[model samples]
Target: MCALSSQVRPARSVPGARARPETAHATRALILATFAFTACFYAWSIIGPLSPTLQKHLQLSEFQTAAMVAVPVLLGSILRVPLGILADIYGGRRVFSALMAFSIVPVAALAVWHDALATVIALGLLLGVAGASFAVGVVFVNGWYPPERRGFALGVYGMGMGGTVLAALTAPRIAKPLGLQAPFIVAAGVLVVATVIFASMARDAAKPAPRTGRVSLVAPLAIFRTSARAWALTLFYFLSFGGFVAMFLYLPKLLVGVYGLSKIDAGSRAAGFALLAVLGRPVGGLLADRLDPKHVLRVSFIATGVLAVLLGFSYKHMVPLTAECLTLGVVLGLGTGAVFKLVAQWFPDQVGAVTGVVGAAGGLGGFFPPLVMAMVKSATGSYTIGFLLLAAVAAVALSVVSRVRGDAR
Candidate 1:
């Protein structure tokens, strides 16, 4: 069990306090937290865009490169469980700033010692700290918004994932002028600036209940055991958010290898995918808010499955491939938003711990696909099998969604 501080603040129900002022405070907190998340995601995913360059320089096999790109994601996924709990106990502002500050060291180290494989891998694991920021930010942002507005607010925060797009578009170009190490150096600087701004500007929401005793470490597990819906959400996110992560990290490699495109062009296309997905997230949230989340999810999963099948056929024409990729981006992005809306709806009281567990599942979802893609590509000498697998998973998720009974609202 994790012991919480005995000190508890009163809820904002004072006679003179008004809703307008509280709304303003919540908006400010959301903005700062979203920007902070952007910085963290940029640092967390920096390695993906650099993987092709690193592979060429180090003569790494496909499996080795996939492993290198995946290390941080694995840590990021597992650490979210604890970090989310800490945010729930200590408050998001403090925990989030501390995480950003801690990440600077490893981001800087990766810049200085990127040539050594072992050192790069070690630093990448430490870089996973930045990835854990998502759980913290989710908990933080969820606390500030009312139930009706949470979906949209969380969707906006999810846009910070555009940081991955930023990395994809900029890292290679930055590496060209300043060298391969420059990207990490710049990412560390961004974190430093974000940490200062967030700590200074962000405020935690008032707690609804006073802390009377220690929070059990096993509480999250207990919640998972009791709530079949939580498990369903976990599986759904594993496909949606996980697929998004896998695509972001693996797309550059795929583009470069399959299309014979230059690294710069590949990165640009990958950035497009990231951008479309990032933009689609908020739309998903808005739809979930207005419609049944299950309906939104059904549309998204079906679209994703259909698109994955079309992509599996391996269209060689640039126009068709680009169209398919962009369409998938929209579906996956919407699915990501819809899944979290469900989380916020179903587990409002345990947002922090629930976010941690579900987010971890999403991260783990992202982790395995690259290895599978790499292995399948290695064995079959094509990415067709990988696309087929994505379609299969989407179908399975759709089936699960159909079985679950609940009011989306």
Candidate 2:
């Protein structure tokens, strides 16, 4: 139901009209939008790398820390759909800049108010602004590329998701040396700079040739209602992107508690897991472009399921576990890229809304696994049960994927 001014204007009959500005403007917008997303997401995920330090300093339990980590993700997931809608109705340039600017306040507060639990929770929820940034990027980026080339363009822009790796690799070590609050101040600074750059430089392509038929508020609902394949894609994303986010959030804990790694070592390991995905993401998109997105989804789900199960068994053996985590990271990253490629191809005209729906599904998928691990660990003091459950979710996703038939869309 949301709408934006058209990006591509109809050609005028008048001779020598300037048309080149549109192309140059759109390219700059894409770069700025990408930068904004990377910074916001980097800040959003810093909690993962800093969890152990936070726990030790604040004297918090595992459940409390897990809840702290999940809060922004949950809020962000819930808000993405609406934000996407808002982007479409208003415009991505304004929405994204404002959100990024607003994120700085809470991150700055966290820098100064480090010891208060209520302060942390409140700040975490506000950081969901980072999560909301994804929708804006999707709408913003999708406007720039033509339909046939969109997969690669979005996939390239999708590299911004790996901002989590920034947190994973640096937060623990940086916070350790400078004190825990320092990273937040750094994150806040980055957000403010990113916001200014995005607002000043980013521009939207003319909105897609507007659909002639009325776009209902229920337009996206029609996707779920009419396309069985939509749900399959949702499940596929749940397994792929969901697992990606969950692992990113929880990998520090897994490293420290399950493997007896030091906090710094755990952050590096978690960084390895997240950093590897950046390459896998674009590769997945390339594969989807060359082959069938559905087939890619099926194989990814099955392979990721097997690897996750193997990882559970490998947990006790360090060498095997490391190999399993690496494999899991690559497969999930490939799948994530493939799923978004399918979305762009499948609903070319409705990329904004479709991206919103799929993006939300991916976020929701990311939300549950950490909570599952938290509950499982709280009850049994082990992650095995949780890993097995993820394996089961993957199996279900793969099974469901088989029933849906379609081309990329």
The best candidate by lDDT is: 1
TM-score of each: 0.93, 0.90
Candidate 2 on 164-276: residue-level lDDT in tens? 98888878878878998899989988998898887876665543234465645455556667777666777787788889999888988887887789998988887788877
Off by over 4 Å in 1: 1-22, 207-215, 407-409
TM-score of 2: 0.90
lDDT of 2: 0.77
Error of 2 at 99 (Å): 1.6
Query: Which residue pairs clash within candidate 1?
Result: none
Candidate 1 residue 141 C-alpha distance from true site, Å? 0.9
